[model samples]
Target: MDSANIVVVSGLLIGLVYGSVGLLSGFCLLSSLRGFWAEGDGRLVRSYALAIGVAVAMTQLLAAGGFVDIGKSIYLQSSFSAPVMFFGGLLFGYGMVLSNGCGSRALVLLGRGNLRSFVVVVVLAIFAQMTLKGLIAPSRIAMVGASQTTTTANSVPALLAGAGLSATAARMLAASIISAALIIFAFAHQAFRRSPGQIAAGLVIGLLVAAGWFASGYLGADDFNPVPVTSLTFIAPIADALQYVMLSTGSTLNFGIVTVFGVFAGSLATALLTGRFQLEGFQSPRHMLRSGGGAALMGAGGVMAFGCSIGQGLTGFSTLALASLIAFAGILVGTAAGLRGALRVRPLAAA
Candidate 1:
């Protein structure tokens, strides 16, 4: 197949794997955190830690093997706005709690016949589009503009190399240290070690991260007209999918759109096969209204943050980009605050 076809096919297959894994594992960062803090479980959180370690290590290996250039990705941009990213991450994290999951998770749930997720997917997509290039652009742009900083060394290895280490040495050192730490943390829990399902989920998810880099960077690379170097990010893709549904005549099929569609299709098939497909909806008008507000925050915040949980937290973090670190912390704090009722979004939990 040609490069364009390669990208489309790769995205569909990757999305299918991601969707199936998401459905079976309940693979969600919010659920992980909630499980640890609220439900006295740590298996899912450990699974996340394992996914992070694997993604980082494999992505670095891909770069080392000359199969992909991690630097080409958006996560390693030379200039970024820390405060804007933090604010956006905070909004997304809190929204995950309010809406009960991130955009990707909502898609998975929607596939299971959860009508509540349909509203969330619609709201999140619309607002994401608005912020991306619509009415909300001015304010979002201004906020990000004020905090933007240009860095000579934007990523971890780059920064270390700037500190006088050789490029290869710096990259290896950074990769080894971080990956080892993550693996240790992930497996520190005995319960997680015992849970084969979560462990398998983590491994598959991490490999998918690397596969995404290979697909877009190597498989899709064209000398004449190249596609954008990206991986499994949901925010912008969700918006693009929405636009595609309405204006296919003007739109061109790309990796992101294909992946978005594949995710829903994959999840639907999984739900049916697992006998988990069930029609569900809001408990009341109040619940629906609250979810709508949360979805709005997630959409706009994802745009500002430049990603969602799996976006910045996984794909971007795999690059070891500084912005991803800041955004991840912001997400953690936001989730904690929301879960603790600090933002007054905990009415349902309190009762």
Candidate 2:
């Protein structure tokens, strides 16, 4: 097959694994954090830690091996807007709480016949598009421009090498130390040890992130018209997919769009196979209102940040970009606020 076809097939297949594993393992970062903070359960958090670990190790290895040019990806850009990323991350994190899931989680739940997620997905996609290139574009771009930081190098190893460390030493040391720390933390819990499914989910999802880099960077790459180098980011692609749906006649297929479709299809298929398929909807109009608002925030914020939880948290984090770290902190803070403390938003009493 040609490179385009290869990219399509690879993305679809990887997305299938992502959907299946996500459904099977219930790998929602929001849920994991809630479980840890609210219920004193750390197993799910540990699972997420493992995913970061595996993704970091594999992705860094790919960068080192020249299988992928990490610098070519957006996560490793020379400059980024820290303020936009933080604010966007905060919006996204709180939205995840309000919606009870992230973008990828909503897709998976929608595949299981949840109509609530349909609203979330639609609103998120539309708003994300708005922030990207619609009415909100000007303001968004302005903020990003005003808040931009022109970094010397985006990735940790590159920065380290620029300081003093040798290139190879920096890559190896940075990847090994960070990955090892996360790995150790993930396996530190006995609960995680007993739950093998979570471990599998972490490993598979992390590998999928690396796989995404490979597919988009190498397989989809064209000398004449190259595809963008990216991995498992949801916000922009969700919008792109929505556009593709409306303008299928004029639009071209992309790795991210195909992957989004694959996630839904994969989840749907898995739900059917496992007899977990069920149709669900909002509990009331109030619930519907909450979901809609949440979705809008997620879409807008994700665009401002240039990624969502999975986008920056997993994919961007894998690159160890300083911007990702800032976003990560913003997400955590927002999540904390939403889940508890003074900023905690209670469900509205029925009108």
Candidate 3:
């Protein structure tokens, strides 16, 4: 097939792996943090850290080996609004708490017949599209335009290079330091090390992120029709997938859209095989309202942030971009606020 087709197929396979791993191991940032801070279980969070470390190492290897030019991805853009991205991440993080999950998690849950997640996914998609191209677009654009700045040194490696390190040396130093630190943090926890399933999840998910880059950057690099080089991100892709469902006659298939479908399918197949598929719904109107509101927040915030948790946290971070760091910090802070402090989401009393 052509380059576009190749990339689309690759996205499907990657998404399938992600969905299976996610369902089996429950790999999610929100869940990880909740488990760590609330329940005092650090294993899940360690898995997430390991995933990030692996993604950074593998993605950088691809870039260094000339297999992919990740600089072409959105994370490495020359111009971006740090303030806006941070605020957006903060909103998304909080929303994840309210909804009890992030976009990717919701998709996995939906595959298992959680009707509540169906509402979350639909509302998130609608609000994301609005922020991207509907009513919220103008306001988002204004916010970005007011604070966005252009910089040649948008990444850690580039910053090091600016500080007198050679390009190759800078890249190596930055990637090694960051990846090693994350991997160390992950394995530092004995509980996490013992959880073979979580470890496998981390390794697989991390490799999938790099695979996404390779699929889009290398396989889809057509002379006449190049595709955007991106990895596993959910926000805009979810929005695009919703639109494609509505406008398939006029729309064309792309990597992100297909990946979305593949994730759902993969999770569904796994759920059925494991006898885990069960119908579920909101407990009360209050629950539905909170879930819907959270979805809306995620949609809009993800648009402003240019990614969701996985989008910015892992995929963007792999690029070692300064903006990703800022956004990631914002997300962590927001998550902490929701998990603790006065803003903490108290557990619902039994009905």
Model-by-model lDDT, in order? 0.89, 0.89, 0.93
Candidate order, lDDT descending: 3, 1, 2
Separate clash counts for every candidate: 0, 0, 0
RMSD of 2: 1.3
lDDT of 1 by residue, 229-337 (tens): 8888899999999899998996788888888888888899999999999999998888898898889989999988889999988899998899888888888888887
Candidate 1 local Cα displacement, residue 290, angstroms = 1.2
- Give the lDDT of residue 350 in candidate 2: 55
lDDT of 3 by residue, 27-48 (tens): 9999999999989999999999
TM-scores of all candidate predictions against the true structure:
0.97, 0.97, 0.99
Off by over 4 Å in 1: 347-351
True-vs-predicted CA distance for residue 72, candidate 1, Å: 1.7
Per-residue alpha-carbon lDDT of model 2 for 248-281, expressed as tens digits? 9977888889889999999999999999999998
User: For model 2, what is the alpha-carbon lDDT of residue 323?
Assistant: 84
TM-score of 1: 0.97
